[model samples]
Target: MKKLVLSLFIVLFVFGTSLSQIRPVYAAENDFTFTVGSNGATVTDYKGTDLNVVIPAAYAGTTVTEIGRSAFDTYGTGKPKITSVVIPSSVKVIQTYGFRYTSLTSIDLPDSLLTIGSSAFENNPLTYVEFPDSVTMIGNYSFYMNNLTSIKLSENLKTINGGAFDTNHITKLVIPAGVTKVDSSSFYNNNLTSITVLGNATTFGTGVFAGNPGNLKIFGIANSPVYAYASSNGHTFVDGTVLFQAVVSAKSLLNSHLAGTGVGQVPANTYNDLSAAYHAAMIFVDGIGNATIASDLDNAAIPLTSAISAFNAEIIKAGNPAALVAAITAAQQAMTNHPQGVNVGQTSAANRSTLQNAITAAQQIFNQAGQYLQGELDVAVAQLEMAIDTFEDVIITAGNPTALGAAITAAQQALTDHPAGVNVGQASVGTRTALQTASNAAQQILDNAGNYTQDQLDAAVNQLNTAVQVFNAAVIQAGIPTALGAAISVAQQALTDHPEGTDVGQASAGTRTALQTASNSAQQILDNASNYTQNQLD
Candidate 1:
């Protein structure tokens, strides 16, 4: 009789509804349905119909430690509905499918929570989620099909299983540095504009961004795993410092034009008149506050208007009607060549408006014998330069050195072909040479692959392994383990394809040892990527 009763209980436990009869323990005082277990207590089912449900920290003096599987799933019956949930600090685990297919638009998870079971909050309408620092693991499909626009990951987060944040409206993300392992599909099909990974574990599974747009910008330290992965896989790697420097350079180039002899062979006295405004701009740019780089840049750009006004007055006094017409024509030309062309989006539209305003203002003054100052032309050119920098940032994020090299070569060839239109100066020559050199280095490794002796392949593998160390360090710093997973996989496969002992020699033994070490390092990166700390892996 006991055996038969046990069999029936097992069947009932496997299905959710039967658990209610086994414990009829409703803490009427607390108005919650819970069952006591070895550890403490778990909320098995909710009895309230409030759209905003708050799970209590304790019921009947036992801390509510878990939310049972499918505890809040409506099962498509819609008998019970909830729009928001507040999880308490005492609850540690949320079991699988606990909140799946709900109308929930908001949720509050406490730091005490450690794991979120698969599909726990899938198909919700959540716009944002803030993971508490205590969270370690987020299961597969946990946040799948949500309308998430943003997510705040915990510093201690370890593993993010496949499809964790797939199909969302996420525009930007910062993967915490501690994350070591990420399933390739974890972020699949998301609208990601930028993703910054703190770590570089390289065992990325195939199709990591399969359904997502390919224009994702990856930011990380130079010579890091993020760089290697992005470079190898043809994603743009935004070198943080380099990009900032480019911004500074663009501003400086604009400033240089305003510094000396007011634009284009002006009357001798005009220089002195523009000097005051020029000096002010220089001082402002030099002592620019460090509140925010972009804002500071804009602040520095403001004084350029004063310099242009001073120059315009000079043109009016000189009565240079022809120069005024030329200035207006230049502004029109600038408006025509606006850096961001058609179909570029809202930012481009705004830029276009600003450019048009500059042109329109110049034109209004043109009929009054107003000449366009060099400062005004410089400002327009500066805006175009900034736009070019933006394009460069995107290209860097694309991270394909081969394509960059090809583009560089094509540009150089174009200059050679159209010598009259294109000026291939010293700077251009230097840039071309540098690009060619880097391209040759990368291409040599790829081009000679078929002819590589076993020993040569071993050398190449060693070099790649060295690159991996840099990636690992950056990954740990960034704390994103899954970041490097795919890169490591590709790199390791390349090394493994080379046969052993095909070209064993006097130095082959040493190469073999080195290869073994590299192989071990690669494996370690994969093994500890998702959850293990460096100390644990070491």
Candidate 2:
């Protein structure tokens, strides 16, 4: 009887412990049903009416670390009304069918998530999904039969099981560098346009990209395993290395010449050319995994490299715009110095307009970056200098007109003092006419100062002054006999006083000879009085 009692007790204890181990410890918190485990709690089910649910990170003082199978799936009692769900960061694993056959249009996967069980999100209306870097394993048909148009796989993801992303609308894919294996039919039966494999040694199972487009492009390094696979599988293969290098070189060139107003800056035309080539190359680079042919990439790479080389060569031949820029600055300063207006000492409006035009043209040339030719820049500088000179001359002549006015006044006064006539003491008609003509011309110039240049005004002033001097010299003063006339009168008096015959109280033979000689000399001088002045006679 004692042995039987001991065996029964032992069986009961064993049975009790097994039952305890098998039966989950259930708890409820915030509309979540959790099964407590050794490490933490697992969310088993949600009994809520909210369309957008947020699973708690902890329940009953235990961290929720896992999502149990069929936790929100379309089982006997389904929660198909949930359109979106927010999984907490504490949850690392989602077991099979955790959210399968639900109305989940979107699901927020945390970065702490590690494993996604088979069919975890199968047959839903999801349009987009992205796996976090912490996720490594993706079970078969994990996102199968969905409306996923785009999916971003984790960079750290290693295994993509069969049918993991099958029967979706994925058009392009970039396999991460860390991915090692893609299982059979991993991305099958979709509208895939291209796939870029970053790793050269990544293995692909059969039918990994089956039922995609026939002309689908596979981009990778030249002669890589992915390339060989693409060739053997009757798919188009493109080597992206050359194009990538071309892009890098183009970017480097662009960065090196980004300064707008300094040494080594690129010309606008050349910079625009480089920009066009770089953009074209980027188009191919951006389309590496999508519809980009190898020949097209090759074409773009050659031009892109050529563009970079061309920019470098252009830099070597870039002309200096500093001279032109300085000239423009000087021209502007001159314009400021001689402002346009009708006031005295100010530049005329017309001259200022011309100078401003020239300055504008020069400025345009200066803004041509380093592309302007030396000849063109020199021409611009010359034109601006000419304009400045002209402007200053006008300001000096037309702007002030003081010298011209004074000259005209002096000439008029001389005319008033010396009237024109053929009389003995009056000015000669010819000299008076000449003086009047010069004075009239000068007066006209002074009256219309804006119409004449500084040179014209100066010439007029000089001519008028010369006329006045000539008129003054030509005039004979009253009672002041002409030099030849005075000499004749003295000679006549001597001749009358001293006769040539021998007479008492008369001059001797030598005196008579001297008087005759003096009269003859005076006669000669009187005959040519037109050539002698009063001072010469005296």
Q: What are the lDDT scores of the predictions, listed in order?
A: 0.60, 0.79
Candidate 1 Cα misplacement greater than 4 A, ranges: 1-32, 77-79, 222-225, 240-538
Runs with alpha carbons beyond 4 Å of true place in candidate 2? 1-30, 242-289, 295-538
Kindly give the number of clashing pairs for every candidate. 40, 0
Q: Please give the lDDT score at residue 450 for candidate 1.
A: 43
Best of the candidates, lDDT: 2
Q: Kindly list the per-residue Cα lDDT of model 2 for residues 232-307, writing each as its tens digit.
A: 8898877876765566567677878863544566677888898999888655554566656777766767988888
Best by TM-score: 2
Against the hidden reference, what TM-scores do the models get? 0.39, 0.43
lDDT of 1 by residue, 1-538 (tens): 9999999998877776656556422223254578899877888776566656777778778888998888877866463657777777888999898898888888888879999999999898999999999999999889999999878887688888888888888766766557766676787888875666645452354455556557776654467666776687677766543332233333333444333443334454554545554555444432322122434444544555554555555542223445445655665565564456332121255655655665565556554433445455445445544544443333211112343334334544433432231121222344444444543453575454444433444554445444333322233221355545665666556456544565643334466567667767867766655444544333
Clash-forming residue pairs, model 2? none
